[model samples]
Target: MGTHRPRGETARRSRTLSGQIARVLPLLPLAHLDREFDYLIPPEFDEIAKPGVRVRVRFAGRLVDGFLLERVESSDHPGKLGKLDRVVSGEQVLTPEIAELARSVAARYAGTRADVLRLAIPPRHARVEAEERAAPVPIPEVQRDDGAWQRYQHGPAFVAALADGKAPRAVWQALPGEDWTLRLAELAATVVARGQTAVLVVPDARDLQRLAGACTQRVGAVVALAADLGPAVRYRRWLAALRGDAKVVVGTRSSVFAPVSNLGLTAIWDDGDDNHAEQRAPYPHAREVALLRAHESGAACVVAGYARTAEAQALVASGWAHDLVAPRATVRECAPKISAPGDSEQALDRDPNARMARLPHVGFVAARRVLAAGDPVLVQVPRAGYVPGLACASCRTQARCRRCNGPMAVAASQAMVCRWCGVTDPAYRCSACGGQRMRATAVGARRTAEELGRAFPGIQVVFSGGAEVLDAVKPGPKLVVSTVGAEPVALGGYGAALLVDGWTLLGRPDLRAAEEALRRWMAAAALVRPDGEVIVVADPGVPAVQALIRWDPVWHAELQLAERAEVRFPPAVRVAALDGSEEGIVSLLGLAQLPADTEQLGPVPLPASSPDDHEAVRLLLRVPRSAGSALARSLAAAQAARSARKIDAPVRVRIDPIDIG
Candidate 1:
């Protein structure tokens, strides 16, 4: 179009469109098209076609959206470059830092950069982009207070390091009765006080609200990033941070990618939460993302929680991060008085059948006393809903649906249904016992609440779990029944907490079962008053339960790391999951050249993936941590090759799959 350039342009020689050229990354899911495409910056868009801005360009035969990666003086393309169709926005939504982060994450997860950016940057809102952006707010210096951090041995030192602009990595194990939200807010404020920015990522919107409230009084110019915020509002808030108008960002997983400049710190609370694991392609964990961002930005990294995960322990073991924890004496003083079946006094007074008791003898006594004392009693159940479990009343056998052979469950309406196939079995008879009666084999929150209400007739019974989780419960002589991770924080803390049905959590088939069970137990226990009691209804001898009794999660975490390392599992090694039709997986494997010491496991059937997935299987590749990058490249290259060949049945490749059950 430029002056009707000579036909054929000297046999496809470049149609020179000045020296200005822009390299753009098209937002397409195809792995084969992962790299930037050279595009000519026409005179019309020369002023607004800067890097990081959104633009539309012609690719193949259709128009596609892309982000301007950078400008180059010349292009290596031998053919004529496609001029950008137009600039979508003059505003740079994708900050260079975030762009770099997305690239690093893509490489780490063996995913296309486009996919990571899709998660990092929300969809653009034309109206929001046109709105006047907020001016940068000056960060207020917070008075350095050792209010909460002083409880930990190196906590105060960590804060001081941040104030001095020294980057330190810490795995913080919060003590019982500790105000973790307030502590996280103070940590962000410490970095902000130094005129830098900080990011605090939690697991859910509930935590986001609490954290946001805590930061308002301490961390100035704070903005929240969450999925629940409407598209326009979320985009406006994200734009605020990108414009350098916010000093602190606090929200859920997405906040880990906040584009605040002058980065000082990145922290994640309750990093082990399953909610923090992204379900999309690449499947990045928020904690890992925080660690990466902190490393790239030279910012302080804090992984704070009541319990330590195996990944966090690996950091401490490798000397990559220090353990910030309280001394034994201080921890004990703040921890609730714990009672287990193994304790001598409790054993002497315990009922003979305490081993399988839903409410242990000591637990019932503690709950009664706490309720009588006018303080709330918190009962933590492992599962939610009413009658989530069903058993044969006659033979004491688990009830299963006749059609799908899946476990049966009864709803609150007193109707039985198959948990897996969704078939109603109102007139069901036990296959083994031929009995039409079903009993609750495992008690859920609703059933527990109903039982507790009957046990304590005069007390109020509050339910906090499922679709209606309460953030906080007022202190009073009430009984609170909740599922793990859904326990409401009671003002001044509950008088006592009873962690019931612990066997369900400990018996899960997932790799993180033991660690997760302990984490959930400790999180619930942490909500009790210092002088109050915590009674967990599980065998005290189990390592996880023992860790809770001693209030030393590091012990369990270290043990887990050692155990997993011996088996070449995660945190010590890297594992990737490849699943699809046997044909696709096998073809992909044959195409990829795996690194040495790559152990192949499985070819296991994935019948549960879908009813028609009976023939689909999953194969796992385990490799040494040092070879993770090479392994990712090999897998990604194989995927790209398959895509290039136009293979219809695609194999799903995920590095560090959420659960290897």
Candidate 2:
């Protein structure tokens, strides 16, 4: 339990009677009300109103939830101070370390501290708070293989530094055939062995399951805080970490803020996954949060993944972190043999239409060979469902719904429907050619599985994507179709893998197209056996394809970073995206008065929010890396100004948005 509360209330104090003042961060989410307010602390609740505890305070004539940041003997406020209504609970939920981190993140993202706090702290569960914290469990000494460590140039050194209780930051590229979860578990165990805490963050619940299982087997006990594990259960696990009962914590995005004392390491896997980006206020990315937490806590940091992000490359380029990558020989020895379109004249002659074919001859041959070998064949599709998009058969014009102008898609029942509005279009006609016929411009996992099942008869077809995501598939002569990031692990590794619809991902309008495509491809390819083959249905000349062929994601990241620097994009520079009504954006921009070198990318039109609503648009403001902080502050001030004046046309601000498309 926490600090004990008195049985009976003492004499109530007033603002004028006692000078005890509590600086409270009211849970008001308004931009103008982001700062703390001074509240008079009643003598009866003075002990519980200490820093980092939840407290209720009268704000704007009503009691509102707030956190007590600190208490002082006197306040400089000229106006009368409000008294704290009561302390919500005696448990200290927020730590000083996390408080500072929240402030830094808020400033960096041009968001209110209250918004970041909402993301950082879970909702109060009175019953869970009443329960006592768990006792500290002993650490285990599990021996781990050093083979994966020896593959990377600085892997051994990174582990050595961790053992010596020294902070070492590195961006690790996991070699193919490496058990990444087990490797991370071993790393966490090493830090726990030194009586220090380790926090590991992944992208989703399935990943948390794998890492948690591995850590429990290697380390003694770990607190797994997941988003889906009911609020009470999550709070109990979080309290276990906060009370220093668990030395290792493995979870998804929110776990980045785990309050473990004597921190030794902060690590994240797959920094480029879109799932790592939170789609809420403050809009923080898990990789950036993990990095910030590591920096503030002075703990060892590692960004381990099959493919690296441009942001991670920036860390290596700035010398803030070293590159922990395997040598070319080691990569080739561990990675599956990969081939792309136009790799050789013979391949080009054999599969001349490989780039255009959904399932090229090489891919079909590889899948067949793998099936004949009595091993699972993994076919990676880029989209989900039966067909993500449809086009006119006559003119190849993208089919769209007339009602909402949204893209048309085919349901599993073969009904044409609008993806956005969900309205069935039974009598669809092409706007370009006036043809009623439609064809699948892009095949999804289900469509691909249906086709492959026909081609490879007498073999079970397993589908993993959309709502029916399989964690792992049993190894056999079966065809496994999956969407990227949803590829199920095959026991003993896949015999062959086919990355189809490469052009769809590579040709996206987003600047991160190539980088994202490589990340998706490499993530699926790495699941193949060392001796297996990977066939990519993309042009071999593309850098992403070549990188996959050579299993060299580092080169791709470095190239991406250089390109971004040349063009002044994220990591090389900072961009703040303003998305909302045109008037709101214009008003915010005028009020902001951004720096001299700010480059305005767009006031491009976004779809109408509703028939009665104003047309929305997005404007991107770019500045030099050195001006990022200034930009954040300026935008925040402008937002606050608008809020203070009660402007109804609201503009949403996001810093370094993960997807600019």
Candidate 3:
């Protein structure tokens, strides 16, 4: 063989080659590769690289980051490639299932493998060292409450199917008015009793805080993992779960991958929230990630909210999961009296008496009635600050920074600062007309709080929004003004709730605008007393508003789905493509090669930080539901080709986007 070996072949075999050596790596999927390079793998690291362990490599002309994605027996160059620089850690960072899930998600979202990996796993520094943590103490099991057990019995068999360490996946739709939070807590307890860990994902941190308190009262030693946990503590808690120390995990979107040991149940509260979608790279949604994790680990999956999403509804219609419902009579009884301003002829009148705060005829009247009997009222606002931004009343032109195009806000000293981009312009001038006169269009929580304080003279007015002012606000004889996601009221609690300024929420340009608005309304409404009244300050005729009026979320979702189906939007059809600069986007679009039924919507204006940053443009492609998987594959192929080309332009792709503004 040596004598017969061709000279060219032998010479070629001796040359160094650059490319990813391992078949798999533990690192996130969208890692950038500045240049191709060779890496030597030591014999000790060989077994670890079988596919998931962390490895060190010399990349990009420097010792940069790289995941050992896979292993190969020989190099394509036939020449000698350098051995891996070193193995950073022996721990298997990527499991085969996790890797597959990441790939699927990456393909679906038109994202790079590295991007999906980044979202699935936390940062290396964020991982807790198992050795540093003490073993979890074994506590005496408490007797199950009879009432809770009975409620658990009412859930479908699929709910208990998760106890068997199989795919415990179920899509549950709770009829409006039922106390889902209390039911979810009971489900958490049931899962915990089976000697396994559980993860509960809510729409925001406030919900997490509320659920955390409930879980702590129900089960001992519950750990809350939210971004609010300053870096150090968050890392510590994250490590505890990674090391199998903490069992119960409750948090917002990012907590979907919480590393609870022997994972049993993964429940998502209000999965329809746009907050549940990661706005960064890969753009993987928390709902999809949870479903994938459940499928992979045989963990129980529960998707519950006041209103069901089209995707969830589709799952139920397809018979993939069971729909859990409260008796219709229970929903009818528990649902409070909901009325909309639009239903009344005087809704359009600007009369102060028409205002819920002034007339004491709508929510205010209900609040007074409740308080007369000694109860609290909850008010939900959409914005946080006194006034987030200012605009010209004549032209409706917002004051923006000349350099950044970011909305300018006057924060003390009359100084203008861009809320985004952080461009501070001491002397900001309106570009539209060089006008300085600006008026506040929407009143935020701070201003609303101040207004309520003045209006309700003797009654205390408390504010709860971006700031943690919950402690300053007591429950009785007061108006608790708070932002939507920042609502601080407790469960089974508020005597009455007023949903103000429906226009602000419905006016959003996103596709899920109505869905999100309804979720916020329900979350607040659920907090009110069963006999309480929910007065909404908007035309009740609007679908979103009317849904609240009748407490008929199912109907609203159905109508929304019908509209989506007609337009080929998500849950009806699938859309995917890379969004970037003219050339790169064109290249990506060309590579996508859409099918006959599939359509291309735009290479149009993407949400940009500024009008001046024109280097980036968005391209969108829509695929029929039947061709979605194929389209994803084609997009993935395009990505691989682009990566091989080492293109410089940044491209971002998101599948089934929740926000299409």
Q: Per-residue CA lDDT of candidate 1, range 209-296, in tens?
A: 8888899889669899999899999999998889888888998887899888989999999989999999888889999899999998
- Cα distance off (Å), candidate 3, residue 31: 8.1
Q: Give me the overall lDDT of model 1.
A: 0.83
Q: Pick the winner on lDDT between candidates 1 and 3.
A: 1
lDDT of each: 0.83, 0.83, 0.66
TM-score of 1: 0.89
How far in Å is the alpha carbon of 389 misplaced in model 3? 14
Which residue pairs show backbone clashes in model 1?
Answer: none
Q: After the best TM-score superposition of candidate 3, give how far the Cα of residue 382 lies from its true spot, in angstroms.
A: 2.3
Q: What is the clash tally of candidate 1?
A: 0
lDDT of 3 by residue, 1-661 (tens): 0011132343334433343355323232433331123355666665655556666655434454556655655444444455666676766566565666766676666666666666656656524444467767553364445453233324645545544445555666565445566667666766777788888998776678778877766665577888777766776777666666666788888788776667788899888887898988778889888887787777778888877788887766667666665556666677787887536557446344453332335655676777686677778888754342466544445565565333556655676765433456777667778777766656577777787777667877777877564633445676888888766654346777888866556545345667778878887787776788888876556788888877777678788888778766778888764567888887765655556777665455444678787566555577778898787667766666676667666577677776543
List residue ranges in candidate 2 displaced over 4 A: 1-19, 142-147, 385-440, 609-614
